[model samples]
Every structure is written in C-alpha cells, then in structure tokens.
Target: MADEEEPKTAFVDESAVPSAQASGEENGSLGNSWSEVSDMRQGLHQRHVQMISIAGTIGTGLFLGSGTSLARAGPVGALLGYTIIGAIVCNVVLAVGEMGALLPLSGGIVRYTETFVDPALSFAIGWNQVYSGCKSTFCDKSGKAATLIQWWITINNAVWIVVFGSVMTVSTLLFVRVYGEMEFFFATLKICLIIIVNVTALVVVCGGGPNGVATGFTYWRNPGPFVQYLGIEGALGRFLGFWTTFSNAAYAYAGSDSIVVAAAETRNPRQTIPHAAKRVFARVAIFYIITIFFVGLLVPSDNEQLLSASGTAASPFVIGANIARIPVLPSVINAIVITSAWSSGNAGMLNNSRYLFGMAKHGHAPKIFLRLNRFGVPYCAVLLITLFMSLAFMSLSKGAATVFTWLQSLVSIGALITWTTISVTYLRFYYGCKAQGIDRNELPWKSPFQPYAIWASLFFLVLIMLTSGYKVFLHDHWATESFISSYINIPIFLVLYLSYKFINRTNIIPLSEIPIRPLLEHAQRFPEPPEEPKQGWKKLNIFWN
Candidate 1:
C-alpha cells in the first residue's frame, strides 16, 4: 500500500503550489528546504513581535527630522502638530488591529484588501508597499553609494544601490530569527538614548548646568511664537511655518504600520497584534508629546543651534545639549543616531522582504518569493528587496539632501495611501460583519467607536496628503524643482494602479460581495495567548544560570 500523504491545511491550494515550486528552481536555490516545517517554528515569540513593532515605528527619522519641524513651527506649533498627527496614527492602528486580528494571515494589508475589496486592490497595495520599502532604504547611512565607494572605487548612485542591496541581502540571509532579537536590543538602546537626552535637557532648563542658569522659555516670548509667511499682514508667516513643522512631525510618524509586516512571524498574532496596536497611541503620546514638550521648554525654538540643519549631528537635541554646556552628551547622542539608523534600516529590509513574500504567495509576484529556507525565512525575497533598497544610495551620489527630501516625500505619500486603504478596508469589514450576522462580542478584539474611528482616520489622512502638496498650489516663490519631484511618487502610484488594472482586466466588486466573512471566520479559529505573567525573582534565574 502507498504511504499516506501528510495532512495539510485546505487553504494551501496545492494547484497554486506547483507554480511557486517551478519558479523556485528556475530562480536559485531555495535555501534550507525541509519537509514538515512546524507551525510553532514558523511563529515568532510574542515578546519579539511586540518589540519589533515598537522598534519599527521609532526610526532615525524621529531623531534627525524632529529638529527641522521645531525650526519650522515654534514650540507651541510643533507640539500641537504632533498631537494631531498622533491622533491620526492612533486611529490607523486601531483600524489595522481590527482587520489584522480578524485575519492573522501573512498577507497583512494585502490580505485585508483582498477580503474587503478586490484582488487588484490587494495586489496594488502589496506591490506599492514593497516599492516604498525599497525606495526608502537608500537613506540608510550604510547604504549610501558615495560613502561606500569613497573608500575604494569611484562610482555613481547606481553602484551604491547594488552595494547596499547586497549587504542587506547578506544580512537578511545570515540572521533571520535574530532579526527580532536585534530589533529588541536596538529599541532598548534608542529608548535609553531618548531618556538620557530628555533628562539632560530638563536638568539644563532647571538650572542644573555648571552656571546654574535657565533659558526661562524666552525663545517663545521673543519670537512671539509663529512665522506667518503667506499673510498679506500679521501672523500668516507663523501659520505657514507651523504647517511646515506639522508636515515634518507627520513624517516622523510615517512608518508606524511597519509592525504589520511581521504578522507572519508572530506567535498568536490575534492577541499579539491587538496588544501591539493598542500601544501605538500611548507610544506616540509619551514619546512625541513629552519629548517635544521638554525640548521646547529647555531650548528656545529660535536659538541659532535650533536653526542649523547640517546633519544628524546638528540635531536639536545635540544643539541644545551643547548650548546647555553638557559635556559628552552630544557625542553620545550622535552615536545613538548611528545605531538608530542601522536598526531602522534592518527593520525596513525585513518589512520589504515580507511584503514581497506576501505578494508572491498571492500570485501578484513571481512564485520564487514564496519559497522558504530551512530557517523558515523567505531568503529569496529578502535578497531581492535588499538589492532594491541599495537604490536609496543613489541619492548620495546625486546629492544627499536632494535624495533624502524626495525619498521622504515618497515615504509620506506611500504611508498616506496605506492608511487610507486601512480605513476603507475596515469600513467594508464593519458592514460585512453585520450582514453576515456575526456578533461583535465574538471578536477577540473589536475597535471602539465602530465605523466612526475608521472614517476619522481616512479623513485625516486625506487632509494630510492634500496639505502636504499644498505648497505647490499656494506660493509661486515656494516652488522649487525638488518640490515638484516630491509629488512624483503620487503619480507613480496612480499609474501603477491603472496599468495593472488594464493588464489584468480587473473590476471592483460590490461591497456586498466582499469575502470578509470567510476570512474573519478562518482567522477567528486561532486565538491569542493571554498576557504574559509579570516577571518574578525566579524568572531572572533562567538568564543568570
């Protein structure tokens, strides 16, 4: 008698598996191929998932870019701006958690789109995310082409792209499981750095410096707080400055949703995802609000130090530290920024690989991406995404500042699109649940305020996107060639969507027929673990021994 085939989930779709297998062989070695990979091995620990999510959101952008926002908006303006953006980020997180918890599949937003909207929409979202991740990586310090070749051969931005991409690819291949652990350590390091900076600034403001002096919030009073540039008369310049600052604040919060990329690797994703999602608001509130508030209090917004935008070393925190006569703090902070850059780059590469893997699994990309190494890593996808991320180095060759600005704009636009999709997906999900008569109480985690929260997030994101491009419409003098290039990413997205639709002959489905119910039902089966118990003295023994 023939041996019985092993049991597999009906969802695996064996017919689809053949294409992926064929593609795997043609591309390259699948790496670590093994039969009978266990689900537990595939799943990441809850701690890793939660920490990675937090690390993903707190990037070099926050450390290096917040200073620019402070300069654009006075203390008060910057505070208010971040608060508003935080609210929007909170709403987006809730919406994502709702859909993510309901369908804990690796497809993430793409899967949500497929279930709540159309296949084409899913394809577009996944591919766009992949493209955005790759594009954004160029700004990573290690990935800069000029820096890479400066020590050796002279090459253009193209060479930097390939070089950085190869490095990321190798890194991803060498350490898949350790990525989460590394993120956890990096997050801790960043958190410590912020704490030190905040404490030092507070000390300086409270007369703890060598001279026992205080700035006394004089910066706000002198500038009269605001830079109204567009006004025919009074405070209009201040308002425009505030707007520019707010845009920077929003950009700082851009990649918060990166946590979703690791959904596949998360253990008990339903619980882990919801728990992680709930933290977004608190994280933003504490981190952004408190940090900005203290900075405003310690260093006046108009200080010459604050106005400098030279590099990461010229960060407002560093500038404020130097002015306050703090010894060695600036150098320490600079070192932290370098580490933060690496952490952010690592997270970016990880996310891009997952996005590619999800696309391949769904047939939106080549099947080779679906192949996993014995370590259960998507090695092929990781290699390709790393390759593309190196393209970010091209900015260094062309001009670092120009490349950074344009890429930053693209990142903002990509995030806006993603947030919009999340809201719309949730709206459809809400009604789909109702029509199917599924009780809300049965959900593992339900978003509060129902459809209102979803709509509110959508509204805010649209407003940001419009306002982001507002400079182009309002002031002729404000128009720069770089400003125009910033908006190019939006058109790129539209063209990609239209071209895919035309080629695939895809049509949007009616809201009634959305496949949300089935996906939700399938997801509901895998419940999350209860919160981990608080550590006791005995718990420390495992590490000590």
Candidate 2:
C-alpha cells in the first residue's frame, strides 16, 4: 500500500512537459505533483505477475468451495453461476487493466478510486480490503493446515496454524523478487494440479475409472439440473440457487484484482498489465469454467460427501477419484488442495500489505505503515497483518470454526464491493477522459464496450451482492449469523463511505480539474516495449507463459 516515497528530485522539471506542466503550474503541477505518492520497485517480472494472478485466483474457492455450490445450485446452476460471474470478473479485469496499464501505480484500484471517483470511496474500499484480507486468512490457514497436517495423525489445528502462519510471514518479509518467485513456483504447481484434475475428470467421465462406468451426464440427468432452494419449489427456487452460488463464484475469483494491485511492482506494466489482463478471460474459461463443467459431470450434486464438514470429501476431484476407485489419487488431490489454501493465504498477505501501504502513501492511514525495509518490503504493514494471522487460533475453540466460516463469507462480499468500486471508478475515468478531449485510441490499453460493459457488470454485481444470502431471509430458512455475514457489509460500507465524506468533506474531482492531460503525456513519454518474438515450443507455452 505504501512504500518509500521516491524523492521529488527523481521527477522531471517544468522544462520536460512544458505545455501540460505549465498549464497545471497555474493550478497544480501534475507529473511533479503526483508520482511522489508511492514508490515501490518494479521487481516483478512478467512471469511473476502472470503466475501471481493465477495463484491468487485459482485457490480453495475452486478446489473445495465448489462442493457447496454444486449441492445448493445443482450442476447447471453451479456452472452458470460461475460462468456468469467469471464474465463479470473479466469485465472488471479489463476495466482495471486499462486504467492500470496506463497509470500502473501500486494499489491502482484504491488510488484510481481516490483520484477519479471520491477519496472517501477509496478510503472505505482500502480498509475493507485490509480487514477482509487479514480476517479471512486465519480460518483459511487453520482449516487447510489442519487437513494437511492431520494426514499423519490427529493433532490440534492450532499447531499447524502457527506453523503455516510463521512460514508465510517469513516468506512475505523476503525481498519482493523472492516473494514473486515463490508465488510463481506455487502458482505453476496449482496450474499443473488443475490440469491434472481436469484430465482426471475427463478420464472418469469416459469410464477410465476403476468402476468402468462412463458417467457422462448421468448425474445431471438424475438431479435434473437446477436445484430447488429453501423448499420454495420451481423456477424461483432454482433462480435463488443460482443467485446464492454467485457468492461462491465471487470467492473463487477473489484475487483477480491482485494483478492491478501489483502493477507498481510489475516489470513493463504498461505492456505486462494489459497482456496479463487480456489473458484473464482465457484462464477463467479454461481453468475455472472447464473445471467446473467437468466437476458437474463427474460428481453428483446430491452426494452427501459434497458437504463434508472437514472439507475433504467435499472436493469434487476427491469425489471423482473415490468414485472411480482410483488408488492414491484422492490423497494427492487433497494434498494439492491444502497447498492451494496456503497459497491463497500467502497471496492475501502480499495483496493486503500493498493495500495498506497504498493507504498510508495516500495519507489515508498511519505513516508508520509506510515504513519499507531494504528489500522494499512494507515491514510495518507486513508485521501488523501477520499479527492478525493469530486469529486462526480461534478455530481451536468448539464451534468457533463454524463462526469463522460465517465471518469468512464476508470475504466474498468484500470482493464484490471491491469490483463494484472498480467498475464505478472506471466509468468516472472513462467520462473524465472524454470530458478532457482525450482520444481513447491514444491510451496504452482500451477496454472494449466502454462504460456499457462496466455498467452492466456493476449493476448485476450489486444485485448479486445484495441478494447473495437471500434465502436466509426467507420464512423458517433463517440463520441470524448467515444474514449478518451476507448483508452486514452493505451498511458497514455505507457507514465507512459516509463517515469519511462527512469528516473530510471530500468532493468528487471536477472533470475539468481532473489531471488527465499530464497523465496522458506522462504515458506518452514511456512507450510500451515492442512485442517479443516467439518461436517453436515457446510459442506453444502461451497457455501459461
């Protein structure tokens, strides 16, 4: 979030951008005025950012959380839910990617929200990210660490929580490149695992399993596609099922924004950010939609194991393997699932620290959080975030893990809110650019469909976010905790937004006053690198490369 403020001397003088700088000089200097907010090094290579995106996104929400979605929505509902949400996520990626590639700042989303929309909005979203990132890591680490550790013997999950927490904390404190490399390695592993699961699902569907049964769409036929919800019966119930699964889809796509956040630390972000953002749609299609499709084919939505309390049997891959009577595959898949959880926790730490650092850099948070170590790590923010990892210890208490699960539901809500904010920010940015007489074609990246895509996505996302737990409000379908976790963030977000606005009396930047000209000139000064030449097997590596 915050980094060592690069000296203003590093910036170009008035002689550099003579026209725009001189114009702004009368009001406020642009290039000389703005770049001082944050100064993180660009140590993340193209590979690092690509894999970081993969690692952040393809995590537990896909590996294990899909089970509940399958059970609640049935196969068709689950698939449609994820597909629709994935599309919305792609739109968000494009919006953020366009802005991020041009600006490429640390905490790009939060910073953009502040600059284009409202500072109060940015402040609320920034701290929401911090709190969401910190609180959610605990239950995630505790549960997954327990699963992996207990493979050997029955032991307290608290022990494993401490172990994994220390490892992640230490790893995060390492140099930025080291952290990038570590994530790249883990991300590749997760990618490989997803491929293996997809392949295995294909085999299982084709009767390659020990059962010698060609599963095909038998489960979908039997379950009859849409799942009825809350005994409401018929189409409305099915629709509710689909709507409920949106939150699960949200959880799966949580980390897509991490790419935008990491722009400051990314190499050739003007080129890399857009390139990576363009690839998001393909990755979601192949990695998530395809996997979910096969998952629907291989595992029945009604399978009791789909809701396993320990989260082991609930993994559709595990269910498929067991159904096929495949030897050792279940255990291996479970192991991979464990690692994915840890990877998510690690990714969260990295993203949230940057978010906090961004807040501090922008003066929305304490300056102490701006402290950076020799390696350019936000030491204070990292230390504080790590301290919150101890919240996982609460899982040791009876029923507390369940409570934690309910609380963790808020993570998906936070993600939806974050995405909505991004879309709104992008709309403001698009209009602001038009208002300033800037040509969209001159930008580093131009997202397709303009404000329409963002508006449609934002509207539906708000609809989903508001009704994510709609069933809890139904008659005799009530759970107080569920209702709270699902909708409480809405009012809380408003409170944060309004409180900040009321306190600061912050007004949205006028289109005429928005520093679009200097920002465009700044981008013009640094043209993106030429496209790299590719050949032979290297060209084929485009799937991951």
Candidate 3:
C-alpha cells in the first residue's frame, strides 16, 4: 500500500476558482469528487474549540508523567525543560493559528500542508498523526487501566481497557456535537482540577494546611535541584538530566498541536481558531508551569514514590496532598487522574478519525474513509482508527507489552516531526506571500514574529529529535531498541516524503504558482460571525467558554 501509484489527475496550477472547484475541474474524470463532497458538520462552537485546545494537552503527561520527570531531573531541571518546550509550543500554535484562520479545513495543518507546502509532505504528516493518535489512545487506556485497579484490586487491566476503549469509540462514531460536548465537560473538569490542585499546593507550601508545617522550597534545597544522570558527575551530567527532562516535557504537550484539527467542524473558524490559539499560552502558564512549580516545592525530587508503578503514588500532587494530611484529597486526585487519562483517549479518537477523513477527501487515503453518516460523522474512518484501540489488550501479554512500549516511543517522535513541518510550511507560505506582493496585514491572523520564529522552532525541533536518545550512544549505554526508537522515524519520514514525490513527480511549488488568491477570497466571503453580548452573571462565560 505504501508504494501505490499516485492518481494521474491533471494539476491545475491556477486559483481563479475555489480549491474544491479547481480540484473538480482537474480530477473530474477520475471520479475524484470527494473533495467537493461535504461530509463533516460544523457542529462545534467557539467554546468547544477553546476547551478542546486545553483538554487535549492536560492529560497524563502533566499529571502523572511530571512525577517521573521530577524524580529523574530534579526540580530545577524539570522547570527549565517545561519552560523551554512551552515557548516552542507557543510559537507552533501561533503559526498554526495564522494558517488555520486563513484556510480553516477539517484536518487543520494536514490539509494546509497539502495546499501550501507539498502534498507529499501532507501525506507523510497525515499518516504520522493518525498513527500517533492511535498509539496515544492505546497508551491512555493502558494508563487508565493501571489507575482503575488502584480503586479496586480484584479487576484485571484488560477489562478497563476494553471498557474505556468501547466508550471512546462509541462517542467518536456519534454526531460531532456529542463529542464536542463530551470534551467540553471533560475539559472543564480538568481546568477545575488544575486550579483546585494548584491552590491546595500553595496551601501546603505555606502553612495553611492542617499540618501547619511550612514547606516552602525546602525540598529544592535538600535535593540541591539537579540530578546527576547515569551516575555521571559534573556539568555534563546535569545537562543530560535537563535534556532528558526536556523529552518528558514533550510528552506533556503532545496533543497540543492538534488543537485546531477540528476547525472544519467549528462555526466561524476564522474567529474561533485564532482566538482559541491565543489562549494556549495562558493555559500552559497557569495549568502547567505554575502547577509544576508547586509540585516541585511540595514533593521532594528524590522521593521514590515519584516513580511508583501505582497510579496514586506516582502523582506528585497526590503525594503532596497525602503529606499535607488533606482529608480524602488523595483519593479525589487519583479519581481525577483516571478520568483525565480516559479523556485523552477520547481526544485521540477525535483527532485520528478526522485526520483519516481529511486524507480520504484528498485522495491520500482509501475511499472507504470518505463515507459519512447522517450526522456528518466520518463513521468508516472512526471505525478503522478505533480498531487499533484493541492494541491496548497487548498489555496482558509480557512479550507483546515490550513491543507496545517501543511503538509508543515511535509515536512520540511523530509530534516533533509534525511541529517541525508546521514551521517549515509556514516559512514556505510566508515566502510565497512576500513573492506574490500580498499584504500580510490583510490576512485574517498574523504571527507576532515571522521567519525568525519559524526558523528557531525548526532548528530546535530537529535538534531535539536527533538527541532524544543521546544516552544510548554514550559509552556502555548502547541499547539497540532505544537507538532505533529515537532515530527510526527520521528515515521513515524521509522515505514517505521522497517516495511520494518520486511517484507523483511533484515539484517544489513556486511562490507565484502557489494558490493564495482563491483562499483569501474564500475566507473574505465568510466573515466571522459577530459576538453577542451576555447579560448578568452569564457574561463570566467569556473567561473560559
């Protein structure tokens, strides 16, 4: 299937018409009408988009994985790592916001890559996202399974995997609004939990808790705020620890890039997408950075329970709550962690299904994926992606479980590649605008910094991808699987991009040849809907809704 020939449809470089019309003119003879066929419903509101951007990212990565990072890198290392990655995330989100507002499509950046960059790039990134989403869902369920048994010791993890997987699949197959509402509620729960936990952590850090023992920065001073990596001594070791924590930070922010993927199903995307993208920085600052800071202050980095296999103990916040002697807060936090993990799986399902549907619409995937039901849900694509959710069952087997971990590692690389591609595509689009004498001010949205931000993000992303597994290359630290998991996707991405270019005889689209006019005209034709004033206390919805 990887080597399948590209469709020999005529390439219409002109953009006097909309993309759907132009595609019909060039590919009509090939029965390629799916691009014109609207299979998705714009059932999502501005509130749903905002919530999804927050909910998709604030999952096990921040809640559970942060514990491991603290234990490995110490308080200072973890803070620096998350702070750096958060800045990169801000840049990527800004770039995506500018592009998505101009061309708000179903698959967001995946579709943008096809139109603004290369179709071959789109193909590679699209499949990469789909695979990542599937693996993420599997991992979410596995983590949820582990957390579920913490509540009850008798049940097997396989049962929770099946149960959680089934629930997410059903929701994905439903109307898009159902999924949106589901995510909205889950995201609200997460936002509330973060606020509550952060405030409680502050209480513990100060002497407000029942224990009345002030523990302000005591852990940081005791642990000395830097862990030596692999028992290596010196600055190099601390640097390695920070670098390792940087990778863990990536996992915390994984699904963030896909925040705009559902734009095609959102109302007034020209307004909502850019608006939602702007909120990401605040969310990261409050929910991630502040929370991590307090978690470090409350929970010592050297505590063994930070790396515990048990769900409750592995949570730094839960452990801190226990130490503060907060009545019943530990159990409450544990339950929220389980729900957040399950929520991540649901978000993954939504992203994967839409990605497949977008690919099918553009002829990058099988035609079966183009099928949509009465509610405009891409049922076929949902079912196909949901099939992979069964992989969660592999956790029951010892040997297959090891393979599952490797697969998860491969998927982790996909986000880095996707972010790199986003910056690259934005650069191409930026240059294309300049060459064509287009006014950037006329665009619906514009990023703060231009080519510099794009280049810096690209350079850093590539550097991280190359060095993600640097430890494996150190003397006496070599491991075959670790080496492959870190570097394998680089070659795989190249193969996919090069092979598609070769098969299709695709060329680097010249700036003048790029189709920007029709897109701008289309966007202008659909001006954003005006906001209605809210009366009374309902106006507070503007804060988060």
Better of 1 and 2 by lDDT: 2
**What are the per-residue Cα lDDT tens digits for candidate 2 across 418-519?**
999898889888998889888899888898887889999999998888787887778788988888888888888899999988986777777766665666
For candidate 3, the 10 contiguous residues with the lowest summed lDDT are 1-10
lDDT of 3 by residue, 242-360 (tens): 88876778778887877678776777777888888888888788888888888889898888888765655778878888889998887777777777887888888888888887787
lDDT pick, better of 1 and 3: 3
Q: List pairs with backbone clashes in candidate 2.
A: 1-354, 1-357, 1-358, 2-357, 2-358
- Number of the predicted model whose lDDT against the real structure is largest: 2
The clash numbers for all candidates, in the given order, read 13, 5, 0
Best-performing candidate as measured by TM-score: 2
What lDDT, from 0 to 1, does candidate 1 have?
A: 0.65
Is 1 or 3 the stronger prediction by TM-score? 3
Cα lDDT tens digits for candidate 1, 136-171: 664544443234233234555466556545555666
Provide the TM-score for each candidate, comma-separated. Answer: 0.84, 0.93, 0.92
For model 1, what is the alpha-carbon lDDT of residue 96?
83
Ranking, lDDT, top scorer first: 2, 3, 1
